[model samples]
Target chain A: MAGYAVELRAVWKRFLGPAGETVAAVKELSLQIADGEFFALLGPSGCGKTTTLRMVAGFELPSDGEVLIQGKPMGKTPPYQRPVNTVFQNYALFPHMTIGENVAFGLQMQKVGRQEVQRRVGDALEMVRLSGLERRRPKQLSGGQQQRVALARALVNRPQVLLLDEPLGALDLKLRKEMQLELKKLQREVGITFVFVTHDQEEALTMSDRIAVMDAGVALQVGSATQIYEQPNCRFVADFIGETNFLEGSVQQLQGGQALVELPGGLSVWASMAQPVAVGNPVTVAVRPEKLTLRPLEAPLANQLQGQVVDQVYIGTDTYYSVRLASGQTIRVREQNNLAALRQGAQPGDTVCVQFVAETASVLTG
Target chain B: MSQPRQSPWLAALSGLVYFFLYAPIVVLIVFSFNVSRTNVVFEGVVNQGPCGPFYWYCELLQNRSVADAARNTLIIAVTSTAVSTLIGTLAALALQRYEFFGKKSAETALYFPMVTPEIVMGIGILVLFSALFGWVNSMLPPGLRLTLGLGTVIVSHIAFSIPFVTLVVRARLHGFDSRLEEAAMDLGAPPLTTFLRITLPLIAPGVLAGAMLAFTLSLDDFIITFFTTGPGATTLPIYVYGLLRRVVTPEVNALSTLWILVVLTVVGLSQWFQQRE
Candidate 1:
């Protein structure tokens, strides 16, 4: 069996800018995708996710390192020789060819027999649910159908690995949501290793088996969706993935996988530790908005702080409360709309308790 | 055209412009049917001459020099258009697709033939060919010496026509998306296969337009041909210039009418190609 479907070892890409300035587009990135795994490279624009995908597809050569497919290093291999295919962001289908011919292009390039190519193209179109569109050109299809044609065009090759660069980015919101689930099901049915690139965090969370979150040409963390969201390794990953409140403090003591921190407001709190921490070292406690609970200030609560509701917004499914602590820091709290008036009708200028346990918060030192 | 905002004044102005522009050609075509030989004025048409309704056309077919001149014009136009279109398309592809040293300079240099005055170009080519022939004759014996001929005129036509062809092709390329080539490569087509199956077919209309432009340019060229042509290589335009100095006949009107017809058909075909695209 082929080992990993795709691998990158210490890859780096440096581009010379218009003014002769060198900028590192991707830096020291090494990753491995298991066979049949749906791996995603997620980041903001200019974060090098697209560049990494291009390097894997052989559109751009790494300035320093190797890319491997099926456990074999591909050195100086042209894109047409590699055992992989790419679905470009623009869906670059040939305008001169019909949908059937577009899907059959790869097979024809490989010199497959005529009968086999015809049968395989018909089956591939059927797999994408575009059975009767064999005679229609790309311009005649709708945006969503054209997207399916791009998918079928790449999947017809049955390459060892498939690379997708924001394949659904051009669609409207409703169509993009539908395509997200369709792509996941399609990947499983084909059982091909899919390496997707996207900037949408929710898409990566919904579709990827594992994700590498990148920023500024470097991958800050790589993990499952739950691990990245609940136990991020750094503040950037925590803030980038979701809304998190940072409470600055210094470590007073270290317990079993937990740190006791003293806040600037003279409050001592406990937060889960994911990395090494020394006593008296400065650290930031990151807690998601939904993780923190808000209650009336006079309630009998342990480990709670007095805060005033600064603002309140009801967004149909949930209500967001902006609360300001006595120590001059504002934090957001989210509560489900199950409650009648959102946190029991907590309005601006009302006093409340911002309460959280150690398990809901993580300590970040760097 | 869909806006429906036409004003009669603007329409009348354009109509007047068209009348002025086409009146001379219309007069020429009408005179080709005139039976009078001198063609100073329209005497009559149809059943007046023994040669039939197309009297001047029959005279033109019988004239030997007209046939030779027509043949020479076709040979020069076809050969020069094919060569210029090929080389110019290659130059356009190279300029548009690659990053190289002096690329800016090369792109700017293609406009030299386009912006330079055609009369200046004609004189320069004459002096250059004369110098070249002088050097070749000085080295060789008298029987084998090179001189200006059909080959020299053809070379000059190709030189002037390339810039127009390249500019036309380059304008078409400005709107092309390069990612299609990458997608072809990703689909396992090699570079040559991708170019043959994808690039050439997509850019075909632009190449045809450039070829038509080159052909029309080569057909009517007179100044360059006048200086560079040798014995027995006179094209229709140069031959007509010689006839102008000697006599003004209705056959010249017939030739001009035929010239206008060929240009109109070529232009019609080019428009058809663009609309099909």
Candidate 2:
């Protein structure tokens, strides 16, 4: 197995829109997917994640630059010649073929021996936990079952890389969660590089070893799930990956890789600078909701903001408090419901202090 | 709430519509078994009990001209259907997959024959073929002159049937999920293998339906065949028309009934195939 299972070298894809305008679906983008890694391309619709995957699978040739699979440049190579298989978003199983036939299609196309094809198909189906109902047509199975068949069909070939294009986008939330875990387990067991594309941030966070957050045909940031969540690099990444409270301010001073930012209401807080910013430059500080702790008014914390609790949303596992700060900005604070006895933390209209460790906040430019 | 009952007037109106649609077919079927040779009136019922269920059918079968015409009809229908299906399916695939200049115009041209008046289309084809044969004969040797015949009729049938087949197959392609072919190709199946193993089977029902429709249209064609056919190329419909012009015989009714049966069988089989999907 190669170190980099797939590498997209400054790839660019352009499409002609319906109005005859040139639309860049993917700009000059470069990415390297390591072998046996569960990498996710996370973005909203039309962010070119699917297009990038298709180019890797040899379905679409890049308008510029090159796509290399296993360190070989793929120029004009058709999809059939590529050593990769795709699980389509719609689970495009052959409706005319039975489940077993669908799973065996790739092997049959490769002209594998009959016994080997049978054994592999059986094993693939068993891997997806669909062992008994092989003779049934694709339409006879439920959506989740059909999705599993699609996975089995592609995995039976044992391609070097598995490309999944939002394979769980159609399922309900509960089923999607189940399949997310199932897919992660399957990827680990198979030890094949899986490039998954999805718009669901939570799904990507839960299932991916690394994620590339993309927007408007550009990869905004690439990092591990925790790195992306806890340490987003830009304003868009900070906002897109999860909920975060932003405080627009100017840098007061820079010292020891940390900068003091002055907020709107004469409040000063320190934020770790991932990128160097000079003093007195405009910056945006981002802090996650869960990172902020609700404390009583007189508590002496290193970084604290006085706010009035205006709203409380009681979800099953956690309670979200909406606090109106003195700067006229509303910030959200999430508290886990850990107490056995029902004890209200802060009622609406009560004054509270929102505190956070200074180093937990990130300073972003632009 | 109580369910509303069907209005008596609406039910009667629907019944009238069905009667209007099926009355002629029912009358034709009833008269096909008439005992008398003349079917202009109920003269056979006054003297004889009724026409035999098989007498005219046997008589028509024994007639050499009718037999020849039936054979020619079958030949023309089968050959034209096969040719049209192949060409139309290829055309449909091209239309579905590719974009080129004048593609919209080509799609519109495909639908022209379907909506044009049959008489106008027949006359147009007749004129076109006459001019074509005239030019061909001018170039040929002096002794041999091209004229309209069975081959000409088959060609004309294929020309009109291609559009219908294309329309049917295109409808099927509309519902098809294109990702299935991509998946096949991704799984190491070459383009030809992907088409044959995946696309062809998935679209087989549409192709079969289109072929069956073309076959029935070619078998029962009258106006176009009448204008395009020569003496030796008389199909079953033209033969029956000629028989009607000479004398309205019970044999013509028997032939009509048999034609209806063949058409019904073909259409029913096509429906069965389509519904299986």
Candidate 3:
């Protein structure tokens, strides 16, 4: 990665209320994005991600600390002087201007030569695959088209960092998926750092090289997608990133990286690691559904736990089973639709045994 | 398709309202060419009496005082509209897009001029300028009496029109997204340039609509203009008022007809502009 394109050091922002009360929107946020890196601020709404982005954009000023762009302190430097462009969630295209005019707006402001402005505008539009839509007003375009126009307008200036605040949020499900791929490709082609903000976990995982999962103005974890998904640092990150079946228990045994946990009904299970917990300390064991294996009622397997099949669902690619374990706890297991149509005729009352490797699940200490 | 039809009483009530509103306008247009000066009775002969339609219409057009009044009215309307629209549009943009102390109170203050009675506003402005400034008697030439003539009338019109302009433009600005300005700014346009190149063009239609409304308000204004205006600044409405009390003439009907036509033209143009949005 190149030198940091944008950097924030312990930035804080406070909003004053009508009654002179102060509310901190962004609390001591410190982050850095290298050149050409796509970083995502992933969080639920009002988690200070947008505030952080706004602070970087100079739409807001930090109450404390510093914002740096290309190694310069950007204190009170207006957005126009900042070497960054923002793709707003609503795709805020100039309603009065045509697509071409909107793209040429920045160039015109800098007093760029008219010929150069037109040429650059054409090139930018072509980059976004909107070459022929020059004369169309923003309202005349579809939502996706307007988004592209917005992208082209920002990208025309070739900003060092592109800040996108849920740019694909206004799109429908299928369109959002398509735009995600398009954005990734655009980011690569442009080779500029992208600071994207989103509440959607899947979007962050799909698009970001590094994800900062935030909650309540605090960043819980910042890591690669695999690190975030497989080895979440906290309970919030574990629950937020993906679905995890949590089994609360005290650590019965802790040897090296593996641990055995005793269940409530005299059952014991082995897990990969007991997240730095001492023996008899409370912990929640998290396991992915696909990690477990299901066998016939009497089939022998390592770490056997007997259960009855409460529900079976065929999802074309995989068949899912909701098994009621011996301890009255229900756990889900997904099986790939292999050659054998296993458990097709298994009724809700039929008994089954669930098995999985010790390393497939991890024990999260609380 | 399954809903019951509207009652006849409701339809009759609506028709009565339509008649009540337009019947006077119809009477004015018809009596503009009334053979007799008094519209209550029409002589059998048309254009044969001393109060002929052609003669009165000619008199109304040829009268220098009426012409001067029309010119003054147009001048005041256009000037005040221009001034107020500029100020009001900027105010709207500032109040809508920024966060500052007492913004809510500032907005309320903008609308305060609109709520205050025109007579009250006029009298208050006059008293403030004359008493507070003291330049009223000491600075100005004789016979001025601190009355600003055309200037005072335009200023009063602008004062009344500003609130309306701010109101209309503010409504448009409220629905406007601030992200566009951010986008422009992000792309390297300075704040003022962004406002000029992006914000102003987008909000221009609203400003225009408000200005047109202001012009109409200024043109039809009588009480405030009458209170503020000196002898030389007799606008059309004041002239019409004077004619109503002074003498019987068909020229008022001609002048009234012209005024209605101009109003209709402005209203139609404004509607056309508003619909483009």
Candidate 4:
């Protein structure tokens, strides 16, 4: 087996819509998922993440480029011939078969002996915590149980990779969180590559070892959750991952790794440059809401702004204050509800100072 | 639970509708046991009650022509139902799963036999078979002969019955999720294995219902059978028609009562199976 379990080399997919117009679903997308890695493709609907997963599973053939499984090119291979299994969005458990039969389907297809099939099916069901209910039909089980059965069915095959397309999308938020941890644990125990696709950012962040953030049929960035969140490479990546305050400005000077950006109202701020930016070039400095600290206007800080608190929202865990700067730009600041006495001191129309460090803000060129 | 009170007019209307529907059937059942040979009048003198309960039933059981006609009807019904169900299920699968040129036209052709008047369909089949047999006979040797008989009647029954089977099975296919098949293939089952194990069992009820309908239709057909049959291919409906041409007899009523029971049993069985699923 190769170091990489699955690889897509510059894959492209095109479809003709119902109106006879061509649509590019996935455009020159290249990704390599390593063995025993939990990789996530995170994107919203119409971003072609699902199409990429389908190509690797052999459900779709790429219009251009090649798909390789374990370093062997998959050319015109049917889904049944591929060494992979998928947990569909709807769970897709066989309505006519019992849970046991559904789990044993892959083994029976390989002409395994009856005793071995029975033992493996039992063990798989037990692994999913559905051992006693094997004889029950899919309709008789709850949605979460049905999802477990789908997972067991796919995992029992012990394929080189497992593809999950939004498997937790149908569940409620509480159950989705529970299954997120469960799925990660199972992936580690099985030691097989899991290629998961989801539109939920939190799910991708919490579960994936690495994430490929996609938009408009293109992968914008691929990195760890902390890397993608803290040090976004572009304006879109910074905006999409979490809430951020963007201050548009022109670069005044570049010294070492820091660029000085001059905002409106003659306010100069230093930000760490993600890419090289020449002097006088347009740039945007992005600072996370949580990284900004609110202090009294008289306090002196390295990177400080004088702003008035225009609006305040009190959520249970955190309070958000929308501060309007002297240049008429509004930026949000999130404060944890650690001290109840501190929240009563800040109110709308009150002048406040926002303090942040130069390393906390990232400079984006485009 | 408290029962809702029925209005007087609604109660009367419901009773009248029931009477209108079942009065002829009741009369038929009652007269099947009449002692008189004639169907129109009771045997007892004026204002007398029915004379014997088992008289015509016994007569019908001993009739050789009735037995032969029953055998022919059973053969045609069973054969046509089996053949049409297989063909119609394949047609339904094709229509549901694939797209091709002239698909709409083909679907419309399937419904043509169902909507056309029975007399028109019977005449069309008669003309078509006669012309086809004429051509074949002209090409054959002199001693061998070809004629319209049981084979023609069975074929005509199958032609009309297929549309009904297709309609029922297609309705079942509408509720089916195509992802189940994809999931099967994802788990390493080939296309044929997936269909046999997953697709077939899910749609079995619809196929059975279609077969039952086809069998009942073939069993009771009169116009098409009358036109397509020859000397040795008289089915039950045609035999009853022949008996009616001379005079109405208690034997005819007895035979009709038994046929009603068979049809009811088949329909009831189909409904039971469908409800069970």
Most DockQ-accurate candidate: 1
lDDT of 3 by residue, B68-111 (tens): 99999999999999999999888887887788899989989989
Per TM-score, what order, best first?
Answer: 1, 2, 4, 3
- lDDT score, residue B119, model 1? 88
Query: Which residue pairs in model 2 clash with each other?
Result: B34-B51, B35-B51
Best of the two (1, 3) by DockQ: 1
State the weakest 10-residue window (summed lDDT) of model 3 chain A. Answer: A339-348
Over the true interface residues, superposed, what is the Cα RMSD of model 2?
0.7
Which portions of model 4 show Cα errors greater than 4 Å? A299-302, A339-345, B1-5, B43-52
Q: In model 3, state the lDDT of residue A345.
A: 44
Instruction: Please list the C-alpha lDDT of all candidates, in the order they appear.
Output: 0.91, 0.91, 0.84, 0.91
- Predicted complex 3: DockQ: 0.75
Q: Which docking category, incorrect, acceptable, medium or high, applies to candidate 3? A: medium
Which regions of candidate 1 are displaced past 4 Å?
A298-303, A339-343, B1-15, B46-51
DockQ of each: 0.88, 0.85, 0.75, 0.78
Candidate maximizing TM-score: 1
Error of 3 at A8 (Å): 3.0
lDDT by residue (tens digit), candidate 1, A45-122: 999999999888889999998999999998889999999999989899999999999999999999999999999999
lDDT of 4 by residue, B1-277 (tens): 8899879999999999999999999988888866676877766522222324666766788899999999999999999999999999999999999988999999999988788999999999999999998999999987787788999999999999999999988988888999899999999989999889989998999999989999999999999999999998999999998998998888899899999999999999877766656
lDDT score, candidate 4, position A44:
85
Worst 10 residues of 1 chain B by lDDT: B46-55
Model 3 per-residue lDDT at B85:
94
